[model samples]
Target chain A: MRATLMYGAGDVRVETVPDPVLRAPTDAIVRTMRACVCGSDLHPYRSMHPSATGRPVGHELVAVVEEVGPEVRTVRVGDLVVVPFAYADNTCAFCREGLQTSCPHGGFYGNHEVGGLQAELARIPFADGSLAVVPDVDPASASDALLHSLLALSDVYLTGYHAAHVGAVGPRTTVAVVGDGAVGLSAVLASRRMGAERIILMGRHTDRTDLGRRWGATDVVAERGGEGVERVLELTGGEGAHVVLEAVGHMPAYEQSFGIVRPGGVISRVGVPQYESAPVGFGSLFGKNARLAGGPAPVRAYQDGAIADVLAGAIDPGLVFDTVLSLDDAAEAYRLMDSRASLKVSLRP
Target chain B: MRATLMYGAGDVRVETVPDPVLRAPTDAIVRTMRACVCGSDLHPYRSMHPSATGRPVGHELVAVVEEVGPEVRTVRVGDLVVVPFAYADNTCAFCREGLQTSCPHGGFYGNHEVGGLQAELARIPFADGSLAVVPDVDPASASDALLHSLLALSDVYLTGYHAAHVGAVGPRTTVAVVGDGAVGLSAVLASRRMGAERIILMGRHTDRTDLGRRWGATDVVAERGGEGVERVLELTGGEGAHVVLEAVGHMPAYEQSFGIVRPGGVISRVGVPQYESAPVGFGSLFGKNARLAGGPAPVRAYQDGAIADVLAGAIDPGLVFDTVLSLDDAAEAYRLMDSRASLKVSLRP
Candidate 1:
């Protein structure tokens, strides 16, 4: 079986690797149908994160169960499923509270027994709790776009929904989404679906902003930092947005969020913050009572509803996949995503 | 008129000062009936905050209206009122949302036109918005405990309620109040009032913890730091409290809170954080999905209900006043509170 590996910064390759086998009674072996390069994968690709040399590299996937152990009850052979990035037993107190990412026994793929989804065959633990089976439908009858969009429910789309949900975006809320990546655009789609009256996308990319408008952004602010804050404040009658979705995890993006959230508003941050400590002084959130909430998304908690909406065509988050490649071009897929040349790229196994 | 002045870090003095006079139509001259040395006042007394030399220093007070300008319509002469530490217009968006501390036209008493409350008279701005009139009750007819409790309602009691309210403590929740100060005890009271079934008070002082128990703490953890975390975890069966109220603003207090909160729980901090930045990395709040919310207490927003509760004799928060002094001994009151010889001290002008 072929798998993608990152040997070092700027070095990615597709190598023939031994196939995964069931190791536990609850395990299932999944044959990868579709895998994608995630924005987070760029962290290690850029030499910013610890180098996991020669390790399996991808997390997002739409796969089919090829084999299931005796205890795997919910999903079985021949079922197409969306794999959430994290594996959880789905029954812990944290999981019951919809915080699966923090489940007592949960761990992310590529970090635990499951190698990675970018491989042709991968092991899945706690199969019933980790896999969301797609409804029985003929793949030959579905459009490529529809299938790709369903694949997004595996991670990014649900992550975006977590941003909107935690930010408390809904009717009577004016939302400001920071960042124009796939997740940010998905957040725009999510805010709209959540009944937000006005959505503002903060991005400098004309191409992405165009798609953002189509997805549901009522306005776009191309400025950054202080100027960007002014533009957002101007758009919302000088009070700033009631709900701010921080999809960029850098200092600047976090600073802009603090500046643009109205007093008593919430800033839900889904972006994996790269900084070790954020200087939230009395001047920032304290005086204004701005609440900050969000983390590694509980995708499993949101998977069912999000997939239903995507299948119903309420949103086509797959539009974020501006490029696609074959398994052999996995290296090139990494290059395209790392260089920001593609919003997102999918690989067909 | 006489006022208490902080001329240096360890120097406090009672000196004759010009009587307060209404400078605007919105102003009301208040004759101070009761004033107290606040826990926050100790911040400057200990030189943790910048010392304001030759400046009046108290912020909590219960006063009787001595005179009112033409624009002061709600409060009239001889009306007893609780003066919230921060003065607000009570009509701005922030104020309307019950975030009066963030009100655009509001400012802390000492920082604004009102010099300070530890004086014979104070010139209050936004009288109609900042003054919560105590229901008709003669000082001669009412017990000193009753009036003292109303004074507590001005700052500490309302501040405690803010902590519990922001922490989202209610029925079926296990609450932990961190701090043995007046505000922390008030939080215990507030949490019980909010219907919290199990309340844990984390403090080492037997005297304060005794009072804490009387205020409604179901259990007390007389430990600090790692040991404190261990005790709290043990108390909650290793899952931690559902709601943690952080009334102490230091780093250790904040760190203890993170250690004792269960995954997916909320930590509401009302303490004025003294540190410039908090290390809320992936290792801390993000991974656990623990939410952090709170800031300066919006005392005015919680004043009415809190005062009503105290006046009804259902609870007596004034018990926190372990010592009292006459107007001439205002400096001694500060010394007692700063030395920890008294939990709280009241001054009668």
Candidate 2:
């Protein structure tokens, strides 16, 4: 089975690997039908140290169940499914509270134990909780657009939805989405679905910002830092956004979140932060009486809703995939995404 | 008029100053009926630089309106009122959003222009919004107990209420308050009022935690640092509290907040942070999928509800005042609060 692997910065490759087999009664074997490179993948692509042995890559996938352990009751063979990046026992207290990412027994994909999602066949643990059936969709007959949208449900789309939902975006809110990546654009789509009347997309890329505008961004601010904050404030009538969806995790993006959030508003960051410490004193969130929310999104909790929205044709989340290739072109896919040549690259296994 | 002044660290004085006069259409002259030293006051007391001319020293007050400018429509002479520490127009967009502390025209007391609440007479800006009339309570004959509770409404009690409110404490929540100060005790009171069945008070001071127990603390964890975190986790059945009310603004307090918060929980800090930066990365809040909320409590927004609760005998927030003295003993009041000899000191001018 061919799978994606990374040996160092900017090094991505597809090589033959042994097929996965069910290791637990709650496990299932998934034959990947769709997979993609994520924005987070670029983080390692830019700085990971070189090594003789490569690490597995990719965590988003739409696949068909090929085999299942005896205890796996929710998903059976031949079913089309979406996999959350993290797998968890759905009945755990944390998972029951919709925080599957923190479930003690849960773990993310692309690890030595679970293997990567960008592969021909993969083993899934806690299959009942980790897999969501794609309602009314046939795996072999589904369009690439539908498959791509379902793949997004594994992480990106659900992450953006989590940011907007937790930030309390609504009809009364003016939303500011920071970043033009797939997740940021997804935030625009999610904010619109949450009924935010005013949506401001902040980014430097005209190409991505254009897509953001099409996805319900009432205004686009192609500025960074103070200027970006000013543009968002101006677009929101000088009051700033009631909800700020920060899809970029850099300190500047976090700082921009504070500067553009209205007093008593919320800033939700789905971006994996690059730094550990940031100002949270009187000069920022405290004085403004603002709230800080969002983290590793519990995508498993949002899978059903995202799938419903996607299948209903209410959103075109798949549009984020502007480039596609066979699994063998994994290196080119990484280069395209890392260099900003592609918003996201879908890989066919 | 007699006023309290601070010349430097640990230095306080009672001196005569000019009587307050109307400075704006929204201004009112408040004849001091009751005043108190606050936990925040200790900040300036500990770090202020020595100077020839001392700065005014108080903000909390329960007073009688001596005079009101033409535009002061909500308050008038002879009304007994509870004043929020900061004054705001209350008609601005921010104020309408219940964020009076962020109102552009709002300002805190103790500045040279407004004098201080610990004075014979003080000038209050935005009188209509700053003063909440103590419904049917008589200043001349009201019990000292009632006066103290109303004074708490100005800041401490309302601050705790704000923390509980923003953290979304409810019947389903297990609340942990991280401080034994007036505000933290007030949080125990507010959390109980919000219908939380189990309330944990974290502090080393037995006296204060005793008061907390009386106010509805079902459990008391006197441990600090990692031990405190472990105790709280034990109390919550190893899942941690659903809401952590952090009333101490130091880094350790903030760290404790994250340590004991359950996944998807909220940590609300009402303490004036002593530091500007803290961890919000994968190792802390982000990994836990928790939220960071709270800042300066918007007392103005909760002023009315607090007065109603206090007057209705639903709460006795004034018990935090265990010591009392005349304005001439302002210096002693500061010393007692500074040395922790007094839980809080009530001053009569």
Candidate 1 wrongly placed segments (more than 4 Å): A48-53, B48-53
TM-score of 2: 0.98
Give lDDT tens digits, candidate 1, residues B167-284.
7888999999899998899899889899999999999889999999988999999999999999999999898988899888888998999889888788888888877578665777
DockQ values, each candidate: 0.77, 0.86
Interface RMSD of each: 1.1, 0.7
Candidate 1 per-residue lDDT, tens place, A175-294, comes to: 999999988998999999999999999998899999999989999999999999999999888888999998878889989999999887888888888886786658888777777788
Provide C-alpha RMSD values for all models, in order. Answer: 1.7, 1.2
lDDT of each residue in B1-349, candidate 2, tens digit only: 9999999998899998888899888889989888989999999899999989999989999999999999988797899999898888888988998889888889888978778788878899988988888777667899899999999988999899999999999998999999999999999999999999889999989999999999999999989999999988888888899999999888999999999999889999999998988998888888887899998877989988878888899999999999989988989998998899998999997
Clash count for each candidate, listed in order shown:
0, 0
Candidate 2 lDDT for residue B59: 90
TM-score of each: 0.97, 0.98
C-alpha lDDT (0 to 100) for residue A74 of candidate 2 = 76
Scoring only chain A, what TM-score does candidate 2 earn? 0.98
